[model samples]
Target: MRNLITFFILNLLCQSLTVNADELTVTLLGTGTPIPSIERFGSSTLIEHKGKYFLFDVGRGATIRLSQIGMYPSDIDNIFLTHLHSDHITGFDDFWITGGIWQRANTLNVYGPDGTKSFVEHTQGAFSLDAFYREKQSSLNLKGLEVNVTEIKEGLIYDEDGLKVSAFRVDHGAVEHAYGYRIDSDRHSVLISGDTTYSENLIANSQELDLLIHEVSVIEPKLLQSNPKLKSISKYHTSLQQLHKLVEKVKPQKTVLNHLLLIGSDETELSHLLETKFQDKNIDVGHDLMTIHLR
Candidate 1:
């Protein structure tokens, strides 16, 4: 199926934004959380501005999801990670290794939190033997196998050609250095809420945005009572109730909910409830490969 439901999902939510080629294009390459699902892939997003592509959080199945949207792994030259969670970075090996095989154009550019440089080095070390034989191939581009890593903290990390990428810290349980990203290109902007739970810093950075892609988890109250571990995990992400108020306060021109954790609850009814209550807010649930064009 063609899962890039930009205009379709927008219309269903009682709002719409046109596809403008000369503007920023955001594709929800994978929208699943840590849990595996056939419907959703994982937490990955692809953004293109001024003929350059950037990826955020290449979780499991990211490379396969990218292929579904007319993009190969080689297209992902730059990647920004939220945290070093296993689920958030599991697909990196596939993206990095397979992308090199597909003939990438240049060195891998990776930006992440404190341990980013170490992570990149370790990934290379773990796959040295595989990368060695592949590098020996005469047909391959040697530069594609090289990597450039930047350890990011708060404030601006990337600024070039009217595109500015700013990282802001967010709360994700014990994950001390979790971050939410705000990307601004020309007059348009979008904020990607990486995994978080009631983050005031995220709210502060989310003041003005054309689109806000947020992670949400709706665990049934009874489930939390029955399973203590579930309760602990619930603290790691924002609930629909919290997001309801969040969308109202932040008030982005459009909001898409991804990385859903709907345990023992009806997502359709709840999503509809939120949609009806905030029709003017232009909010919708994100699925894998859903692309939103911003002008």
Candidate 2:
């Protein structure tokens, strides 16, 4: 009996070892903001690990971009939302109704910070007519149209099969409970800083992570001077200077900028500015559809 138990343990260890050799891929499905852009879409990210697909923040055009990446809306069952911001969740209806169209039979599991339940409930309520129409007029499975919303706090919200996700609080101006997420798999770990000002909580949670994807905005004095509203907005989002300090503290292997607000400079210029600040560190200005693989 003891020999059999030892053999089972060995087999499990070997399986784990083999799994570690596989790569986890992160695809930036959309890297733009609320502002419309032909070159970029709103904020959505897809993390594919061990054949499982997890999505974070379904912004505008998320499902369309997912289709572009060879994934149907029905392929994703688990979605984590950082906040209830319009830009972050505008694509919810698209994903929901479209997935229904594609015969998604599984319940959509959505996780988010406090107020998420109300947000989703209201959203579903708003889509009641469309949902009812689809159900009556089409053969789509309305069961998958059902969303299971889970409001999360600053802790481990999900853990299964060596994949874990933790949520932490972030300051988004007056928004009380915005969140950032840390995703840990068997081999790689990543943190996504969903629209936030520099938070010590984020740095503490993101220590030595494989990748840190943080939001950043251009901080030009003239632009801020000209647009008082943008200046106010800047207070809620991280400036390049603030990002430099945050990156200096957290020190992830690679840092990618997302939710870019290009008020002063273009993408290349913004990337150049970031590179100059963190000369020794690896930095990439995120763009839509950019895929990074972690092995």
Q: After superposition, how far is residue 256 of candidate 2 from its true place, in Å?
A: 0.9
Residue-wise C-alpha lDDT for candidate 2, range 103-192, written one tens digit per residue = 886888999988888887887898888888877888556787788989887899988767898999988998898999999987789999
Candidate 1 stretches greater than 4 Å from native:
1-22, 137-141
In terms of lDDT, the best-performing candidate is: 2
Candidate 2 error regions (>4 Å): 1-22
Task: List model 1 lDDT by residue over 1-295, tens digit each.
Answer: 3466876776765532223433899999888877888888878999998778999999999988888877877877789999999878999999998888888887888999988888888998998888777767655666677889988889999998778999999999999889999999867999999999988899999978999999988888899899999999988899887888898899899999898888887678668767677678788889888889886
lDDT of 1 at 224: 84
Candidate 2: residue pairs that collide: none
Q: TM-score winner among the candidates? A: 2
In terms of TM-score, how similar is model 1 to the real structure? 0.89
* TM-score of each model, in listed order: 0.89, 0.91
